[model samples]
Target: MSTLLSAIRSLIFVIVLIVTVIPWALGVLLLSVFRRGDPIYWACANWLKIAIWSARWICGVRWRIQGMDNLPTAADRRAGVILLSKHQSTWETFAYPALLSHPLAYVFKRELLYVPFFGWAMARMDMIHIDRGRRAEAWTKVLTQGKRLGAQGNWVIMFPEGTRIPRGQVGEYKTGGTRLAIETGLPVVPIAATAARCWPRKSFLLRPGVVDISIGRPIRPEGREPAEMMAEVKAWIEAEMRRLDPDGYGPPPSGVAGSVEGGTASGPAQPDPLQALSQPPSRP
Candidate 1:
C-alpha cells in the first residue's frame, strides 16, 4: 500500500476507535455501579472486538492464528495458563482479548487508569495494574491478583520483554511473567505474533497485511526457576517469530547487531510514544 493511502486508513481507524470508545466507556462506568466481574469484563472486550473489526475493514489489517488446540478447552475449568507473548505493536494488546477464548487480565502500569474514558472504564474491570516504581509492591500485587484471576479462569497476559520491541529485534526478556507462573503453579503459553508487519511499533500507520500469530504448546512452570523458564519462553517465541515472519529477520542492517545465541536479535530499542495510549488497560 502507498504511504498516503495507509495514512488515510489509519486516520480513519483512529477516528473509529475514538468514536466507539466514548459511549462504550461511559456505559461501562454506569454499569460498574450495578454489574461486576465477567459481565463488565466482556462488556469491555466487546468494544475491543469492534476495534479489531474496524482495523480489518478500515485499515486492511488482518490476522491468521494457529494453535487454538494448544489452549485448554472450555470444559477444562480446572486448567489455567499464563500467556507470555512477543510484543511488537499495539495491535496484539487489542487483538488478544477479541481473539482469545478466555478473558485476559493484562499486567499494565497503573498510570493507564487515568487515560480519560478508556482508562476510567478499564479501572472497573477485574484486572491488575501496578506502580512500576514500587517493585516489591508490584510483585505482591501480581502474585495476589494472578492467583485470584487464574483461579477464576481468566488468563493473565504479560509481555515478557517488558515493552514492545521493534520488528526483527529482541528486547531483554523479563522474569516477571515466568515468576508469576511458577508462583501460581500455572503453565505458561508462549505466543509469537507478527503484528508489526502491518502495525509497526511506535507508529499508527497500519499497512495492509496479515499478522500471523502462532501459539506454542504450554510450558509447565513446576520445578522451574523464573530466569531459566523465561529464557526458554524467549527462545521459543524468538525462533517461532523467525519461522512465521522470515522476511522480518535475517542479517541486521548497518550498525545493528545480529542474532545471538537462543535466536535473540539484538538492536537499539525504539521509543513507543503510544505506550500510554495503546496499552490494553489491566494487570498482566
Candidate 2:
C-alpha cells in the first residue's frame, strides 16, 4: 500500500516537472533563436533553481555542499579545466550548469543529441558530442573540441564513470577526462554528489532527503601521466562517496580494500579500467 502511494505521488511529481519545464523550455527556444542574453541559459538555470527548491518543498529533498574551499578562487578566469565528477543522478546534470558561472562544454554520448527539448538546448549550448562505438574517432573529436573550449576559457565537465551509478559506488575511472587534463596541462577538479537519494535515476519518484555534494581539491597534471592521475582522482572520489552513501546503493569495488582517506590498501591490487564499463546503472 505504501509503495502504491509512493508511485502515485511520483506520477504527480512528474506532471509538475513537465508542466513547469515545458513553458520555460519554450521561452528558452524563442530566446535561443534570437541569440539574446542566453534566454535559454537563464530560463533553464532559473528553472533548475526552482526544481531544486521544489524537490525540497514538495518532495522533502535538500542539498548540502561541502569543501567549497576546494574550488579555485584565483584570478584565472580564463583558465581551462576538466571538471570530473562521480555520476549518481540527473540532478547534478542540471545543477552543475546552472550553479557554475563559467560556461561548460559537456562530452556526452551522441544519443543525448536526440533527446527532445533538452537535446535541442544542448545543441545550442555548444556541447561536444561523441559516438561511443568509435572510441578513437571520439577521442580525436574531443581533443579538437576541448582545445578550443580551453583556449577560449571555458570549462569542460566529464563524468569519468561515464554514466550514473545507482548504487553510489565509484566505478573505475575512464581515462579520457584525465588524459585531457594531461594533454592540455589543465587542472582537474573532482566533484562528488549523492543525488540518487533524492532523485534516483530511471524513476519518476523524487524523495525528500538531504543530498550531499563535495568538491575535492583540483589536481594539477604537471608532468603526470593520465593513467596515474586517473587512479588517484578515482580513489579520492570513491572514498568520499562511501562515506556519504553507506547503505551500499553501490558497494565499493572489491579491488579497493582500504578506506579512501586511509590511503590505498597495502594489497597488490592495481587499478583496472574495465570496472567502469561493468558498473550497474543507477535510477534517475
Candidate 3:
C-alpha cells in the first residue's frame, strides 16, 4: 500500500482505539466501585477484542495459531503457567487476551499504568506492575504475584526479550520469566508470535497481513535452572522464527531453516514489517 494510504488507515485505527478505550475505561472505573471479578475482565477484554478486530478490518492484520491446546483452559482452575514469548512488535500485546480463553495476568513495567485512560484502566486489572529501577524489589514483586496469580489459574505472560527487536533480529532473552516459573513451581509455555508482519516497531504504518503464532509444549520447571530453562526458551523461539520466516531471520540454505515445520510465514503469502516475530514486547 502507498504511504499516504497506510498513514490514513493508521490514523483511523488510532481514532478507533482512542474512542473505544475511553468509554470502556470509564465504565471499568465506575464498575470497579460496585462490580468485580468476571465483569471487569470481560469489560476490558471486550475493548481489546474491538481493538484487535479494528486492526484486522482497518489495518489488514490477522493471525494464525498452531498450538492453542498448549495454552491453559478455564477448566484448569488457576493451574496458572508462565508464558515466555518472543518480542517483536506491539500487535501481540492486544491480541493475546482476545486469542486465549483464560484470563492472563501480564507482568509488565509500571510505567504503562500511567498511559492516560488506557493505562488507568490497566492499573485496575489483576496484573503485576513492577519498578524496573529496583531490581531486587521487582524480582520480589514478580515472585509474589506470579506465584499467587498462577495458583489462581491466571497465566503470567512476559516477553523474555525485555524489549522488542526489529523484525528478523534477535534480542537478548532474560531469565526473569524462567526464574518466576522455577520459584512458583509452574510450567512455562513458550510462544513464538509474528505480530510484526502487519505492524512495525516504532511506526504507525501497518500493512495488510496475517500474524503467525507458534506455541511450544510447556516446559516443566521441576529441578530446572532458570538460566538453562531460559536458554531453551530462547533457542526454541528463535529457531521457530527462522523456521516460520526463513527469509526474514538468517537465511539458511533453502532446505535448512525453511525446512522446520510449523514456522508458517507471517502475513500469509503477502508481507510487511515484524515479518516473523511471534509477539510484541509488552509495555515497551
Q: Specify the highest-lDDT model's number.
A: 1
lDDT by residue (tens digit), candidate 2, 1-284? 75675666667766777788777676777778788433445556677666665666566666767654555433455777888988888888877765665667889998986777667656666578999999999999898889888776678889998888875454768899989987888888877788888788777677767777767667887878888778887776776677667675455555553222222223322222211111111111
Worst 10 residues of 2 by lDDT: 275-284
Report the C-alpha displacement of residue 30, candidate 1, in angstroms. Answer: 0.9
Model 1: residues with Cα > 4 Å off, grouped in runs: 251-284
Candidate 3, residues 120-223, lDDT tens digits: the string is 88887889999999999999999998887888777899999888778888888889998998888888888887777678887778888888888777788888
| Backbone collisions counted per model | 5, 10, 11
Error of 2 at 262 (Å): 17
Q: Provide TM-scores for the models.
A: 0.87, 0.81, 0.87
User: For model 1, how does the per-residue alpha-carbon lDDT over 164-281 read when each residue is reduced to its tens digit?
Assistant: 8999999999999989998998988888899999999999999999898877777787788999878877766777677678799863335442222222334432212211113332
Task: Provide the lDDT at 164 for model 3.
Answer: 79
